[model samples]
Structures are given as structure tokens and as C-alpha cells.
Target: MAAVGWRGAPGARGLGGTWHPWGASGALSVGGAWAPVGCAWRPLGGGRLAPVGGARLPLRAPERLWGRARRKNPSDPNVEGKRRATIMKRVHMARKKGERIPVMFDEKGQPEGKHGDELMSWIGVLAQEHIPIWIQDWRSRDLDGLKDIIWKETITSFTADESFWTACIKSCGEAAQNFRHDLYKTFVEGFLKEESVWTRSQKVVDIYPNIEEEDWVKFVQYRTSSQFQQLSDRGSEIRTNNEYSSRGGRDGYRKLD
Candidate 1:
């Protein structure tokens, strides 16, 4: 808290003049004189300040008053989540009205704003809407089916033959694969290593209600197999030996300052 004093001439010092506090020093300029606040406004004959009879104001830093500084990038996860939801709502509304869906790409056939985040949001919504498709083992026919689904659902200016369409499918496939691995790691692998198989299975099913019991059982069996264990071990070894490290989090350079 800081105090402010009214500026008055020597003969009229401490009069009923209104006072205002400004700046970090709690000083205000009146006429040609600077009066330091947080004190009594006594005219020391030459505009010198003395501490007394002043009102205190609560001083707060900008960050404390306003909370975290906003990130500039729209693609930042905090911002992009709302943006994606809004786009999804527009898509639904356009469908209901029997109109062409809102497009993410510009007239020049390039994606608007942050393309990487846009593509991820599209595939993320697609995966969420079509959960059953993601749970299955994909074959060539399945990939083609997913490609068709992406082409129909995602509103982009890119044509069917364009590389951008293929890139969408590829990105979606990678995201789906990562999603499954993350699910397994978070739900299954998180159980105590020493716990019995039955106990772990029951606990996993209890904690992760979204996954069907049958699917969980099958997934557990596959993950526990010798082939899967060997692959996991190989991957661990490779990662352990790797010398390279990322400079930032999963978003990497896309993460805003």
C-alpha cells in the first residue's frame, strides 16, 4: 500500500485540495511541481515532500491483478480447445441448415491460421466422434475407409488427389496410434508391477470405465505377450541410448513464449 498527498502552495498547504496517486513512486505532478505521495503534503517552501496525512492505496503487480499472461498463439492448447469447439458447432449448424460446412482453408488452397493445430483438432474430433473405428486393428481396407471418412468429414479446400488429403490421413493414423499407446501406458502400465494379473485387471477396469471389459482383457493379453514385451524392451533400450533431447515440451517450437 502506498499513500498520496495533495499538492498545495506553502501558505495553503494541507488545504482541502483533491489528491491523486500515480506511478510506482505514488507521485503526482501538479502545475510544475512533483509531489511524492504516501505522506502529508506540506509545502516545504520549495515543493519538497514530507510524510504525513496521506491516503494509502493498495498497489498490485499486473500479473497478480490480471492472472497469467495470455499466449499470443491461437494454436496454444488453452486457446485452441475453445477454437476447435466453436468450429465444431459451426459444422453442426451448417449441416442442420443443409449448407456447405465452414472451410478451414483459404481460397489459395492453404490452411488458415495454424495448420498443424487445425489438422490435429480435426482428427481429434474425428477420433472422438468415431471411437469404434479407432479401437480396431487397421488393415489396408481400413486405412482406405478412414481416408474416405476424413475426406468427407474434414472441410478443406484440398481435392481428393491432393497430397494434403493424404497428409490428413497420415496425421490421423499417427494420432490414433499415439492415443492407444497413451491409453495403455496411463491405464494398464500404471498398475503396480508386483500386483496379480486378476487384481490389476479389476483395478484397471474400475479406473478406466470407458474401455469395454472384453477389449481390456484382449489388450492386456496382447500387451503381456512375449512379442510385445520384447518390442517394449527394444524401444526402452533405444530411448535410453539416444543422446538427443528436445528443447521444450511436446508442442516444441509451436509453444508460445
Candidate 2:
């Protein structure tokens, strides 16, 4: 508790007025004039203020702010029910006669926008559809019969495709530098001709003898790769180095009798 003048109280300065009590001054601004605002006054000028109106102002207890706050109002369930009924009536009236409400399905055959209970299986719908197609493919059907070479054409048959690169871009998000480096390595490892590596290495050393060790390695790799080599010469176009020795005792077109 502290001594403070209660404004507008008896024997004290009312609104828009100052008080000089106990040689101390107390004032508040009201309509461009100084007034006392129930605040305590202290002495000034390096001297104790002598009592003017006699004793100090009475000690007033602070107001209880918590008790003055508004309490939350209780909800009216009937009003809430009326609001819900009105909205439902409007929604039903807006719908056509034969039109059914559209339902949404997730992986678990439950509605969309629903939480927790709407679970999904490990296998996706696309996976379920494609798995049977793969199981019944020509290759799988001919598994027990005479089999053709799966890779009749080499990896060089593939061209740079926008769709493939887009898929790679989707799979590899932000760390594009490392992804590109790995993609380059995959291209080289998958399509490069290992048979020509020795020949290409010899050619690289001959072409640039003063190259650094790392540069020499890169040069050999590029030379043996389909990116730098003529794909036709190194791929299906190149004939074997063997020659045909003819003359099988008879003429041409030998028949099985």
C-alpha cells in the first residue's frame, strides 16, 4: 500500500487542478491543464516537503484487475442446432433430384480429406495394375521356351530424352551437382565400350603425351565412350575382323537330303 491522493475525493484536488501538499507538487494533464491523478507526491528542491493539508494522503489498495475481466458466455446448443439445420436445408435444396453426392477414395477405399482412419496399403493402385501386365508379358510367357537375347541392341540405341531427364530431375531434388555427376557416370559405365579402352588409351597418350595423369584418365574414358566415338563404327555396324574361307566341296546352296 502506498499513500496517493484519490482524485475528486473530499479534502483533495479534484479534476483539472494541482495540489501543493507537504511542499510537494502532484498534477495530471486534463484539457490542457494540470490536475492531480491520485498519484503520490514527493518533496523537491533538496528539501522535505512540509505538510500543507496536515498528514500524508491515505494509503489506497490497488484495484483487483482479474475480478473486473469479462467471463466467457456459455454456448446455446439449440441455436447451434438451428444454424446447422438451416445450412443442411440449403445444401439439400440446391442439389438436383437424381444427383448423388460424389465420394472420394484413397488407397484404403476411404474418403479423401479424412484423417488417420483413411489408411493406404504398401502397394499403390498403379503398382497393382502394372504388376499383372509385367507378369503376363511376352518375355515372361516365353520364359520356359526358346529365349531371344534381351538386349539385341546395345545401350547406344537410347537417345537423350526429355521425359527421362525430367524423371531424373524429379527424383533428384536440390543436390543437382552430385546428381548430374552420378548421371554422367551412369551413362559412361552403362554405354561405354570396354573393348576399345586399351586402343583409346594408347591413342590418348600419343595425342597428348604431356597431359596430366587425371587428364589422361579422362581422355581415355571419353575416347572409349559412345559420346565421343562414332556409334555406327563402334556399335552394330562394325563387322568382325574374320574373313570367310569358302569352298565346301560342292557349289552354292547345299541342301539337306
Candidate 3:
């Protein structure tokens, strides 16, 4: 059988040749032929050691090492397509049945008044929860994107039809507007009247514990600006001079019904 050998001199730096049972003084016999030990040249024989290149075969490909090369995330186009298709199908079926698709109805398919108000409150709550972190201006994000995210979050516990989903998105817009107004009136206009910047900044962080300090600072700056003040004054004048508006309180226009 072909054997392995090392050709380095006695006590040399490389593998010892005479270390083998058949080796003698700086040489080794593998099937009666001396072979070098620490070189790229490999012995072409059975059961004899051979030098290998530095390259190694990986057990898995790069993509397969982790997972699929293309994976679906929350905002994936395919996922969006599927959601659109489902909503369209639901709308079509409801139309075919000649039914008025209920918005925020209970599981028993009854129109409960409080259900609508609860959903509006939820929309406002979620808008308040996400907007301070994700959006500086409501216009900065596409309405559809916000709708999708909020709809997904809301549906985790609540069940509603596509009509309610559309209403929820619309309410989110109003919620954003209301949120800005509240922040302005409650904090920016009243409490933020402090002359000290440090005091104002501290108060903003205290009011909105979860919001980033930088974001709240920017909001405070914008609301206190002359341009925003002019806009606010104009809006307040318009609301005050108008007499056609109904005082519906928390029920809004539903009081008319």
C-alpha cells in the first residue's frame, strides 16, 4: 500500500520524517518511495497523505445559510396585493347580497351606538400612540401605508368589515388633526408659555413620556413659530365667526340623527 512520508532534515521546522515507523533519519519510505511532507506537491498513491488547497467547500450556500433569498415582510408587495384582493372580494360579495355593509358592528350584526364611538376613540388612541414616533407631519407619510398598519393593529382584537376599515382610515386623519390641536392647546399654548427653553423642553418630555426628546423639541419649535401662530389664529377666527356649525358634543353629527 502507498504510504505517507516527510522529507525535512533532523529536528527541522517541518513535520518529522523519521517519526513514522518505516522512516529513517530525515527521510520516510511510503511503499519504498520517499515523499516530501510539507509541500504542495501531493503523492499520487492510495492511503498516502496529500497536501490540500486552502479553499474549502461550505456546508451551505450563502442564501441557504440563513433562509430564503426573498422573504415576505409586513409591507411586502405580495402581502399588500393579497390584502387588496380580499377587501375587493368582500365588497363585491356584500354588494351582490344587497346588504349595507356595517361599520364597527357587533358580532351579532346589530348596530350599537357605542360601538361607533369606541372605534373612533380607538383610532384616536392608536394615532396618538404611533404618530409622535413615526411621523412629524401627517402629510409626511402616505395615507394608505398608515391605514394598512393601523388596520392590521386594530383587527388584532376587533372584527370589522371593509366599510369600517375605510372609516378607520378617515378617522385616523381627523385623529392626527385633533392630536396636533390638543398638543398645541394643552402643552404648547398654555404650559409652554415658560420663557426658559430648558423648562419648556423638560415640560414637553414630562407631558409625552414615550416621545423622543428631539421630536418633541421640534414640535414645540414649530407650534411656537409665528407662521403656525398665524395659522392657528386664522382657524380660531373661522370657527368663532361661523354660526352654521351644530354643537354635537362627543356624538358629533350623529346627534342630528
Candidate 4:
């Protein structure tokens, strides 16, 4: 372990950390972040940072530390991927010549519109080719991504309408069957509805992964940090306060975000 210090950052005069070359390595404990242990040194401006005040910044170190300080967070592009996956979770398998129709049925367990005919046409092709195994073949790559593929392509696309429900159920290859359950009809229908399942999941932003509250406390506690000082100026920005309803003590929100 070696102590690395920084005095170039304004008002962070004596900030430093003990870098462990071996053993568990992660964010620094003070107002800065540490790069993962054993990042091979790269040339300045190409990897983590350019030369700073006659010093070459350690790769990924700035991003771990102060790059988080004044970041302008744009929307995550991957959310679009998730949203797209949800919309097509099941319909693409039934596509013919590029257009798709989901295995969606109305509440009455009847195939709605021309979906019955479309299912027959798609299934007819699959049956003629004897390619039920193709489903498994298409799914086997990128094991980490399989959950999304299965969710959007199989389970999320189950149609309860009896007219072609049998075809959809039988069309799945064994690999897909491993993750599915249909203990009851209504449970299947509710989960398959576009609005009822994936859309609701998409709206959630789990702060645990993104907000390192323990790490944040370090920066806030370093009172001499100019970056922390900047955050202090914005601390009182108007925000919603949670309140309870008088009649039943039921909880609700007054969202300001």
C-alpha cells in the first residue's frame, strides 16, 4: 500500500488515500473514488483522464472520484433497449415477412381480430419446417441476455385465447418451458398484458445500485471540499414531502420530480 495525495483540486488541499496494490480494491474512503486494482496504466487523455497540473491521472480514478461530482446525467440509452424488449416479448416469433402479431386475446378467452389466422399462418411455417428446436437454438447465446429474450419472447407473449392458445403453448421449445408456469388462466392473462407487467417494472428506478449513500456521506462530510460546497447551495431546492391522509392514515405522494 502506498499513499497517493492530491492538492491540485481547489480547496481539497490535503486529500489523499492509501492505495492497495493487492487485496480488495474499490472506491476510496474519503471524498474520492479509487479505480479497480490492477488497471494497466494507459496513456493520458485516452483512458481515465488527460494530464492534470503536470501530473498524469490514473486511469478510471477520476471517474471513480470527482467525475461523479458535476456530472450531467443524460437519459440511459439502455432503458430504450428494455422498453423495446418489453413491447416485442412474444410477437416476433409469429412474424411473417417482418410484421408481427402478439398472442394477445381479449378478457373472454377468445382470440381477438385476425390474430387467430395470423397464428395459424406462422405456426404452419414452423410446423412444415419441423423447427421447434430452432426456438432453443435462437435462445442459447448470451446466457445473461436470455432472461430478457425469454420474458419478451415467450412468457410475456402467452395468449390465453383458446383458438390458438394450444399452438402457442406447443410451439415453445424445451428450453423455454423450463421457466414457465400457468397454474391458472387468470394469472397467465394478467402477466401477459402489456401494461400489467413489464411497463410497471420499467417505471421503477432502484436507487440501491446507483446511489452509494455510504460513499456519498464521505463527500458530504469533507466540509472543505469545493464540490461539497456546491452541493450545499442546491440542498434546499423545493421537493415533495410525504404526508398521510387523515381519514384512513393511508399513504400517498406529492411528487415534485
Model 4 per-residue lDDT at 157: 37
Higher-TM-score candidate of 1 and 2: 1
* lDDT of predicted model 4: 0.33
lDDT against true structure, model 1: 0.47
Instruction: Supply candidate 1's per-residue lDDT for 18.
Output: 27
Over the stretch 1-257, how does candidate 4's per-residue lDDT look in tens digits? Answer: 44332223343211332222233444333224335443332334354342323234555453333332333211232432343344344356444335445545545443445554344333322222232211323335444343334334433334443353433434433212221111112222355435333221222224112323443233223432576446546542322232432110000111111
What is candidate 2's TM-score against the reference? 0.13
> After superposition, which runs of candidate 2 have C-alpha atoms over 4 Å from their true positions?
1-83, 94-97, 114-257
lDDT of 3 by residue, 171-207 (tens): 6666666656655665556566476542345555654
Q: List the residue pairs that clash in candidate 3.
A: none
State TM-scores per candidate: 0.46, 0.13, 0.46, 0.17
Which stretch of 10 consecutive residues in model 4 shows the poorest summed lDDT?
247-256
lDDT of 2 at 199: 35
lDDT of each: 0.47, 0.28, 0.48, 0.33
Error at 15, model 1, angstroms: 50
